[model samples]
Target: MKWEDNRESTNIEDRRNSSNYGSKGRGGNMMALLPIVKILLGTKIGRIVLVIGVVAYFFGFNPLSLLDSSVTPSSTQSKVVNKDADDKSARFVSAVLAQTEDIWSEVFKKYGATYQVPKLVLFRGSTRSGCGFASAQTGPFYCPADRKIYLDLSFFDELAQRHDAPGDFAQAYVIAHEVGHHVQNIIGTLDKVQKAKQNFRSEKKSNALQVKVELQADCYSGLWAHYSMKNFNSLEEGDIEEALNAASAIGDDTLQKKAQGYVVPDAFTHGSSAQRMKWFRKGFTQANLESCDTF
Candidate 1:
């Protein structure tokens, strides 16, 4: 992938280690918390409450109670500051985001509409988002409420080491996929899906809708790749394969098998390996948004 001469996105906000850590987005009852939060805050729930209290005390309302990762761009750019070595990665992300802006802007114009570019947040450990706090373990996500993308770059290491999806393009694919979610939000696909979800007969059926949502995102990522290849010289000889590997590596079935030694379609929020590869390839082959209407 060639990105050296790419333009960096002005819609990025770098908040690597600034008063936002250990925050999570899965609000209400926290299920995944049983494994990480208890161990991190001590084996007692009372201690965790105390920690929240202390945070709210010193920082005044946890300094993150209203953690909205969306840093709406002012006329002035934010000052560059961080406590980690994420500057380079942040710059790469900004470049990819800028490329998406260019591609989508042109695509929108073709349909007699304007494109609104979303912001990207680069954080370490944890950060607050529109919905709530988020950790890197959430992987990369797009918060429709804030119209921003949240990513922890460390996920790239896990992508390579654990998922066997190693490549620069795979990393870019991760971000682009989340950006696809942003696209869904902009075009009202997300709201339509969420509304339909309320009528799902069971959790399994609802999860099925989630699979569609994710598969469409894969298609959208392919749409981004189409532009990235044509406009920027970002597509190398093996880049497409790298992204397909990522699509397969992170399939819900693969992840469930690895985590629980069994595959459960009923609980699958994302799609299966075959389905993921199919949708991603579909988008790549067509490179047309009209063909990506999974909703």
Candidate 2:
């Protein structure tokens, strides 16, 4: 939380100023063509038009380009409004990322391994990721395929306002949680889980495995916080409570109860509020890899 004067990470990719929509507004153009395509597919002649349109698309031409107001290049290239606030958020993210990089690098060294630092990509509204096209709705995620973490600054606001998890440390915990996934990827936990998931046909079994994965990541975030606090004295008075509140706020049971008025334990992809808080506290207190074995 005390990050204003801290070193900023160079691993950040600032794509906030670039257009978040698909290339040349192709996504928008497709939306415009959907109604017409739906109507045309109802008749033989319309089917022919659909085929022609498909062929044109393959040939580097778009019939949708003929539609007026479908090709707004300026709209796609416009600058971000409220740049000042976003810039401040970007700085804060870079500082926190740098802290994670430093702490994780040391932790990996203690294991006789070099830390392969992950790049963090920052974007607005939407952007392309190695896993797929990502929008703000996708939230903060780590894509193992690209070994990159994708984030939208708006999520911090939503975390504060919607989830009632305000505080800079809560934002830091979110970043650390995703970074924990990268650590899982590095340690082959993700690979093992993927293989283990293949052995289960039941969705409940698969979700249980996923819950372990998520809870382990939560523990790893606490692990990071432990070393961060020990090494740099970084935690403020209420930081841990902020993170715990966030963990509780986004818990499977809490969210399920809010959305559907009841809890379904079988569908839990992340643990209950108690489970999350327990694992995180375990890692923080125990401060060892063995303490984080959620399986």
TM-score per model over all chains: 0.79, 0.82
C-alpha lDDT of all candidate models, in order? 0.80, 0.86
- Candidate 2 backbone clash number: 0
- Compared with the true structure, what per-residue lDDT tens digits does model 2 show for residues 1-295? 6778778999999988764444436676677678888899899999998899789868856466566442423333324567787799899899888988999899888889988999999987777888887777788999989999999888988899988999989999899999999999999999999999999999999999999999999999999889878877888999999999999988999989989999999999989999988888888898777899998
RMSD per candidate (Å) reads 9.6, 6.8
Q: Which residue pairs collide, candidate 1?
A: 24-133, 25-133
Per-residue lDDT of 225 in model 2: 87
Error of 2 at 151 (Å): 0.8
lDDT of 1 by residue, 174-259 (tens): 88899899888988899999999988878888998999999999998988998899888789999999999999999999999999
Q: How many clashing residue pairs appear in each of the predictions shown? A: 2, 0
